[model samples]
Target: MSSILSGTPIVYFECRQCKCVLQNPTPDVLDEWKKEHQGHTVTETRKYPLFDLGYNDLKKAGELAQIANELGAVIADIRFMPHTRNPEFSLKHLQEVLGDKYIHVGELGNANYKGTGGIQLANTEAGMRILHGLLANSAVIIICACWKRSECHRVYVAKEYEKRYNVDSTPITRTSARDLLSSVEEKNNPQLALW
Candidate 1:
């Protein structure tokens, strides 16, 4: 094992096709790290993962569900396109697949069906109130119609959430599963998965 591992960045595991990173660091290690840090524990914790199924193949959904389960994620939003008028289809697809294993959200953020923007957060006071309610309710929102994370408006929205709501509305961009979990750990208020 040393011969193969020597002078290497200890890739505990990896996929043959996708370069998505993976690791098996134990829960005890996370607990110890938490003990060392003086960070505040997240009470109203949520994953708030933003995803785009358009670029992703259907085969990845199960893997996504399993990963969320492993990470103690409570929600897996399957938000739909608002402009198309058939928003329920999004929920139907996820329901046929992931089912009730995680919480589902529709009409995430302010996404227009044209496959752009975060859910168009309400601009008015009533809209802000609604946005706040959505944030308080959701864990992971995967209804974006685009590929690149930069194109998605949720990133900026999450930043604002960090400033205003004091909740982690940010999206976790990890090359692998381990990196994702670590990102969660390093947050101002890390989410403790309820799985």
Candidate 2:
């Protein structure tokens, strides 16, 4: 993993209060990030798609995991009760495929799905502990489908991490599995090629 993102005093903050994600991530920078982390392990977090209703299905998550795996990224599904809305797959299925890389970091377990209520969950002690434990000292990439940077939950997660660790979590704004894979595909061949 490249230390450039972690080595700097400047941390990236994605403010979710206003509903956003990591400000604009330059194409060159994203390409550089991909190049810099050639062999380093990456984690692709699978959450219910923010705007896309199709990705709420667990199968899409598995598809994304396959792409991430091909690109050397481990699948980390942070949803605890992923079956509440998506029952096509079970937790066992995710664990079976993701293996040791699967983690259930349900930061929003107690919060409402409407993004209201418990807005301060990240500021609570338990929330801080969970966020810190999952993010501290580790480089994280937040993925979501919001075109508006300030409206991405991945950005929200990053902001929470920054609030606690005072460090930046890279945010990648892609709306679908294909788009996510394509973003990397634009930078590197075969690695992101899933067609």
What TM-score does each of the candidates earn? 0.43, 0.46
Alpha-carbon error at 32 in model 2, in Å? 25
Question: Any residue pairs clashing in model 1, and if so which?
Answer: 21-175, 21-176, 48-139, 109-119, 110-118, 110-119, 110-120, 111-118, 111-119
lDDT tens digits, residues 131-170, model 1? 5554443443343434456765555444554566554443
TM-score of 1: 0.43
Q: Which digits, one per residue and each the tens of the lDDT, describe model 2 over residues 111-186?
A: 4435565333323466447555544333222333234555435455556556655444443323344555555455
**For this target, which candidate reaches the highest TM-score against the unseen true structure?**
2
Q: How far is candidate 1 from the true structure (C-alpha RMSD, Å)?
A: 14.5
Off by over 4 Å in 1: 1-59, 76-78, 82-90, 102-104, 111-119, 122-145, 168-170, 177-195
